[model samples]
Target: MPIYGSASVAESGPQATVRVPATSANLGPGFDSLGLALDLYDEVTAEATSGTAVTVEVEGEGEGTVPTDERHLVAATMIRTFAHLDLAPPGLKLKCRNRIPHARGLGSSSAAIVAGIMLADALAGAGLTRTEKLALADAIEGHPDNVAPCLLGGFTIAYSTEDGAKAVRLDPSPRIHPWVYIPQVKGLTSVARAALPERVPHADAVFNLSRSALLVAAVSRQPSRLFEATEDRLHQSYRAEGMPESTRLLHDLRTAGIAAAISGAGPTVLALAVDDAELPEAPEGFEARRLDFGSGAEQVATSRRE
Candidate 1:
C-alpha cells in the first residue's frame, strides 16, 4: 500500500506529534462495514535521529506488553512509511501515551498504525491524502470499518474495492449518546470470527440489509428508530458461542428497549441512547460509560527550531 503526496519541511525542527482516536466497528447489522470514532486516544511523539534505529517508550496502556524496539508496531510502520517515500529511514525516539485498551474491541492497533503513518506524514512535511492513509491503514488492519472512522472521525461506512478500501463519512447526531459495557475478560476477535458460519440464509442477508440501511437514518436523526434499525441476523449470534456474556448483555439491553449491539468482534456491548437519556445499570463484572464521538488525527506540534 503506497500513498502519493508530499509533506512540509520541518522548519520547526525534526519532531512530530500524532494523535488518533479509538474506534468501534460493526454497529449492529452493518457488519465489517460501519464504525465510529470515540473520544479515547493514543498519542505518539517522535523525534528524528541520524541512524536507522528506533526506540519506543510506552505509557498508560500496553506499557509492559508492547515492544520497545523496532518490532513495535508504530516504529515498524514509520520505517515502512519512510521506505515507501524513498527517504532514508530516520532513527526515532518515540514516546507513546496510550489511553485506549488493547485487544478490547477498540481500534488500538489502528490508532498505532495511523500514528506511525501520520508521524511520517508530518516529518515528510505532509505526505499522503486522507484516502491514501485510509488505504494503507486498512491494508494493515485487514478492513476499512475501523480505520475509516479512525482517520476521518464521525460515522463511517466502508467497503473494499478492487483498487483498495473506500469509505464515506457522516456526522452522527449529537442527540445520539453511546453507552458501552465492557466485560472483565478480554475476547479475541479471531476467536469470535471463527465462531461465525461460512454462509447465512438469504433471508438473514435481506434482514441485515434493510436494518443496516435503517441504521444510517437512526444514527443521524431517527433516534427512536434505532431499536429496529440495529437488529441483525448476521455474525453477532454466532459469535455468542465465543463471548456468551457479551451476547447476553446485548440481548438484555435490547430487551429493555435500548438499541444495542456488539462492539466490533467482541465482548464489548454498545448501547445507543438519546442525549442524557437515563441508561440501565450494567450487570456485575462489567464497566459502563458514556463516550462521545471524536475527531480524527492531527499533528499537534513539532519541536521548536533552534
Candidate 2:
C-alpha cells in the first residue's frame, strides 16, 4: 500500500471543483496499456462540511441511475482518499455533472475515480504529486490505462512497476482525428473480460507486440500508418460476439482503410483517421461524433478557509 504523507492540513470548509476527461483504453493492440483522453468530461464539486453525512447531487449521464449517497463511486473514493491522508472531514458534499456515457468504454468510472482523488487532495491540501495520484487512482480502478489518460491526458502508455503505476504522456499527431460510435445499449467490462480466452497462441502475442509498438509511433508522429498500427489479434475478436454492432462497425471502418478498434471493454468503437478522411455513417442504435484529444484533469476552483 502507498501511504499519503501530507505536510499540511487544510482548515475546515475547504471546497474544490475538479474536471476529469473521459478515456479510451487499449487503442488497438496495447491492451491494458494504451489510452487516449477524449474531450468528453465529468465535473465534480466537493465541499467538506460540518457533520458525518455524505450528500451528492448529480446532473446528466447518471443523474437518476447512480447512487447519491456515500456508496456513489466519487463519494466512496473521496472517503477512502481522506482516510489515506489520515484526515477526517466531518462530512462531504459533492455535485457531479457528467457527460461521459457509463460502461460504454468511454471511461466514465475512471473519470469518477480521478475526480474524487483530485477533490480530496485539493481540499485536504495533501500536495500529492501526479505520480502519487496515479498510483492511488490505479489502485481504485484496477488498471492504469483509463486512469492514466484521465489524469495526465493526451495519449498515454501506462504500465505497472514495483513502486506502482507509471505512465508516459505523448502529444498525439495533430493530423490524427478521432471519432467515436456509442451504442444505445451499455456494456459490462466484467462480462467482456470473461469472454476472453485464457491463453492465446504465441504467434498472436507476437503480432500484437509489433503493432502495439507501431501504434505508439503512429499516434505520435506517423499518422499515415494508423491504419496498420491499430491492428490487433489479442482481445477484440474474442469479445466481438457480445457486441455485434460495435464489432461490425469496427470491421466496416477498417475495411474502408480507417483505423478502428474497440474502445476499452467496449460496446463503443473508436475510429482514427488523418486529415480529410471521410468516415462512414453510424449504424442504427449508435450515435457518432468527432472528438478532440483531451487535456488532463484540472482543478477548476477551490475555496480555502482563512
Candidate 3:
C-alpha cells in the first residue's frame, strides 16, 4: 500500500496536485460499465520553473528497469498535458513512487496518464473542471471505465458514444467485499484487448446486456443475488484466453460457491466474497487482497527539493 504525501518547496510554486487509485473494471458483466477504485496508489510531484532541462526520478516499480529521463511515462504524459494547453515546458522535475504493479489488469498506466495531466493543469494555473478532467482522461485511456472511477471514485458506469462519453457515479457501499486472486504472471492490457473478436453474436450481446444490468443492480444494492448477478458471456471469455489462470480461478471460485469476475481485461479475478471469507488476506494462497469498494481517487501535493 503506497500513500502520496504533501508538497512543500521554494521555486515557482505548486504546479499540480494529484493522487490516483488503482481501478478494477468489468466486475462480472459490467463491461465498460462498472469499475471500482482500489487502495493501492501512485503519487506524482511536478514543478515548473525557469530552466531548460526535463528531469524525472522514479522510485519503486521501475526503479532500474525504466529510464529516468524525458522518455518516462510521467514525463511524456506531462509534456503532452502542458503542450495541449499551449504552455511551454518550464523546466519540470518530476518524482514518482509507484506501488501499483505495472502491466497487470490494474489501471497503472491510466493512473500515470491521469496524474500527469492533473499535475500539469494544476502547475500551469490552468482551469479545468472535473468533467473536463474526465474527458481528457477518457481520451488518453481510450476508454472511460478505468478513468471514470479513478477520477470520480466509488463504482462507475461509463461508456463512449458518438457524443463522446456518458458516465455516472454509483454508490460504492461497504456492504459488498472484493476478493482478488492474482496469478504469478502479469497480463498485458493491449494483448487482452486485442484478443477480442471483431464482432460478437446477437445472442451473446443480448445475454451480456441482461447480465450487465443484473450486475449493476447488485452493486447498487448489496446482499445481491450473488451467483446470478456475477456471471458474464462476453469480453471475459476471449480475454481470458491469453491468461488461462484467470479463467481457471473463476471456475475454482465458483466451485467454492464464491461468485467471481475478471477484474478488467485481467490476469486477476475480482471475486464476490465476504471480507471474512476463508481465504487469507495476504498473498499466501493465490496472492490476494480484500479491497473496499467505497474508496475513490484524491488530490494531494507530493513534493519538491529539500
Candidate 4:
C-alpha cells in the first residue's frame, strides 16, 4: 500500500491521524536536491465536523505560539488542498503534536504541509496518486527537497520537471548513522539564503557536481567515502557568516574525520558516521542527539463520530 493511504471511514464523519518525519535537506553538495528523513516526527489528527468553523490545538514544540484557527499552517494547507482537488472545504478540528523544532533547519514547515495534505486526502478519500500529492506539496512548499523526504522517507533526490517537482528515494547504507546538533537559537531560512552569492565560480560548480554524484554512492553503498563525498564548494561557506557556531561545529567534526555538514539553512549540524564515532561536546547552546533514518509519512489512526 502507499504510505499515505486514505483513512478507514465508517458510519460517522471521517477523521485521520498522520505522523510525518523531520527532514534535513541539502546534505552537503546536493543543494536544493538532497534530503534525508529523520526519526523525529510531528503528528496531526484532523476531524471533519458539521459547520464551516475551523479550530486547531497544538502541543509540544509549537504550543502557544502558532495560530489556533484557519490561519494555522496545517489548516490553511488543508483548505488549499481541498481547493486543489476541486472539493468544498470541510469544517475541521485539528490537534497537532509537533516534535520537530521550528526554524531549526529540520523541515518543520514541510512536515506541516505534508500533514495537511495527507489529512485532507484521507478524510475526503480523494484518491490522489503519489505523484499528484508530491507535486502539490512541492508547489506549496516552493521546493521538493524537504517535502520529498518528509513524504517518501529515506534518502531523496528532488528535482523539478516541466510538470512539477519530482523525487526518487534510496535506502541509505546500514553503516551510515546520523547525529544532529540542534542549537538553542533558531535560524530563519530567509536570512541564511540571503547570505549566498548570486553566482559561483565555474570550478566551484564542478567541485560540487562531482561530490554530489559521489555523495549518492557513499550514502547508498560506500559509507567509507562519505567524508570526501560530503565536501562542497557551494552554499555552506557562503552561509557561514550567518551561522558561525554551526560552521565551527561542522569544521570540528570534519576535522575529526566525521562527515559533517550544516543541516539545511543552519544553526544545526548533521554528522554522518559509519561507526561508533565519538562526538564532541555540544557547544554552549546546542544539544546533540542520535537519530535513525525514518520511513515515510503514515496514517496511524482514524476516528469516527459516535
Candidate 5:
C-alpha cells in the first residue's frame, strides 16, 4: 500500500491549499534561462470528490475565459500528476483565486502548472521535496526558467542538463526595484516564440552571454550597471514584430536611461530601478505597477472535515 495515498477515494486525506507566485522570465538577454518571482500570486484550494467529475471555480483573472472543468490548467496538471504518480485519478474540486494576468508574458501558465503539481502532491500526502517539485514542474512547462522561479522563488538561473532541467536560486539585491507596464493587449508565448529565427547570429549569441552574465552580477551588486547589463540582441527584437508597442516602449524606456525589457514574451514591459525610482509613465493604454521579488510557495491552510 502507498504510504500517503489510499486505494479508495474516501480514504484520501484533507484538502490542500497552495499559493504560487507569478514570475517574469528572460529578463532581456537571458531568454529561457533567467527568471524572477513576483509578489503577485494565484491561490489554489483542492480536494478529492466523489465520482469522476472534476469541477473548477475560478475567480479574479481568467474567470469565464478559462475552463471550469477537467480541461482547466490546474485540473490538467493534477491529472498529469496522478498519471505520473501511478495513482488512480479521482474526482476533484478546485477553487482558484488568481491574481496573475493570463497570457501577458508574466508566467501565468507556469504558476498554474506549479499549483496543479502541488495540489496533486498535497492530496496524495506525498511529501515532495523542493527539488522534486522543480523537476516535475519544469518538465511540464517545457523549460525551467519560469517554473523554476515560481517553485523556488527569488531570482533563478535555469538550464537543461544531461540529467534533467536544473536551477540555482539567488536573492535579488534590495536596491533593485521592479515595475511592470502592462498593455491592454496580450500576446501568446507560442506566437512570440515562433517569431524567432531557428538560428541566431553567433555575434548575437555572444552579446546575450556577455549581457546576461553582467545582468546577474549587476542585480547582485552594482545596481547602476543594470542599464547596460539588461541589453539584449537575442529574442526581444525578433519578437517585436508581433508586439510593436511593447518593443517600442522598451526601447523608449531604455533610451531614457531606464533599465527596461520586454517581460517574458510580452506586451508587458519590465523596468528596474534603484531603491524607489518613480515608474516612468506608461504608454497610452498601459497600466504600471511596482512589484518585488517573492519567496517560494506557501501553504496558507490545510484542513480535514471530520
Candidate 6:
C-alpha cells in the first residue's frame, strides 16, 4: 500500500488533512551530517467545498505573508503532483495551520513539498511508496534530510544521489532524549548553504568525511557515542556570523553538559537533554518534545516537515 494513503476517502466528509513535523538539521558535527525530526507540526487540510476557485486559507507564521495564488509553494507543488500523476485537477480548499516556525532550520519548505506529494497520493489515488514520494519531495527541494523525516517520521539520516536517496529506518532508542531550543528569530536555509565555501582544502574535507562516517556508525550502533558522534567541520560554525543567537546557545548547551549542535543548517539547536528518557521533560519555550516513529507508516499532509 502507498505509505501516505488512507484506507478510506469520503467525498462529503471533512477535507483531507496533512500534518508534517518540524525538523532540525546538521546537528553540529553532523553538518549536512544529521537531522532530528520533531513533534511540532505544520498542518494542511484540503477539502472539497462548494467551489469554483481553489481557495487557500493560511494561519500561523506565514499567514498573509505567503502567496495565495498558483505561485504559492503549496498550490504549485500540488499542481505539479497532479500533472505528474496525470490526474484531473481536483479543486483545492487548502487550510493551513502551521506550528513549525518558518526559516528556522526546521524544514518548512520540506514540509510543504511532502504535503503536496502526500495529498496527491490520497486524493488522486496515486500509488506511491513513502520512498517514492520522498524522492519526489527531495527532487523538488534539492535535498533529502528534511523530506525523509517528514515522510517516514522520527530521527533520520539520508544519503542522496542524482536519482534520489536511500534511508535506513531505526527504532527510536529509549536511551536517547532530544532537546530542541528554537530561538525567537527566523533562520534561512539559503543563508546557511551560501555560507559554505565553494571548495574546501583537502585536509578539511577529510575531517568532514571522518566525522560523517563515525556519526553514521554511532547512529546505527551505540546511542552512547552520539555525544562524540555528531560533530562537523563543514558548515555550522562558519555560518555563526549570520546566527549569533544560536552560536551563543551552542556555547550554553555545551556548558550545561548537553551535546548540542545546529539543527539542519540551523538556527535551531537540538541536544540530548535527558539520559534514559525517550522524550524530553522540559516545558515549551525552553525545551521542545521528541517524536518517535510508532511503526514506520507515517502520513503527513501539507505541511512538509522532514
Quick one: best TM-score, which candidate? 5
Model 6 whole-model lDDT (C-alpha atoms): 0.67
Supply every candidate's count of residue pairs whose N, Cα or C atoms clash at under 3 angstroms. 4, 1, 3, 0, 0, 16
TM-score of every candidate relative to the true structure: 0.92, 0.95, 0.88, 0.95, 0.96, 0.82
Query: Cα lDDT of all candidates, in order?
Result: 0.84, 0.91, 0.74, 0.90, 0.87, 0.67
The regions of model 1 sitting more than 4 angstroms off are 1-13, 304-306
lDDT of 5 by residue, 109-176 (tens): 99999999988888776787877888888888888889999988999999887766788998899999
Candidate 3 residue lDDT tens string, 92-209:
7788888777776778887887787788777665776777777777777788888888887777889877756667888854667776677668888888889988898999888878
* Rank by TM-score (best first): 5, 2, 4, 1, 3, 6
Best-performing candidate as measured by lDDT: 2
What 10-residue stretch in candidate 2 is worst by lDDT? Answer: 1-10
Show pairs that collide, candidate 1. 7-125, 7-126, 8-125, 8-126
By lDDT rank, best first, the candidates go: 2, 4, 5, 1, 3, 6
lDDT by residue for model 1 (1-306), tens? 222121222223478898899988989999989999998898899877655568899999899999999999998988787776677666678999999878778888889988988898777665699888888888877888888999999999999988789999999988998888888888777787888889899999999999999999988778878899989899888888788788888888888888899989878888888867788888887889889998987778876355
lDDT string for model 6 (1-306, tens) is 222222232233334577787776666665552566667777777764333356778899799788876666776787778777765455567887888777777788888887777766666666788778877887788877777777776667777876687566555556666667777677778878898888777887788777766766665566667666666677776888998877887776666666678778777777764455343333333445454432222454323221
RMSD of each: 3.4, 3.0, 5.1, 3.6, 1.6, 5.8
TM-score of 3: 0.88
Who is ahead in TM-score, 3 or 6?
3
What is the Cα-based lDDT of residue 67 in candidate 3?
69
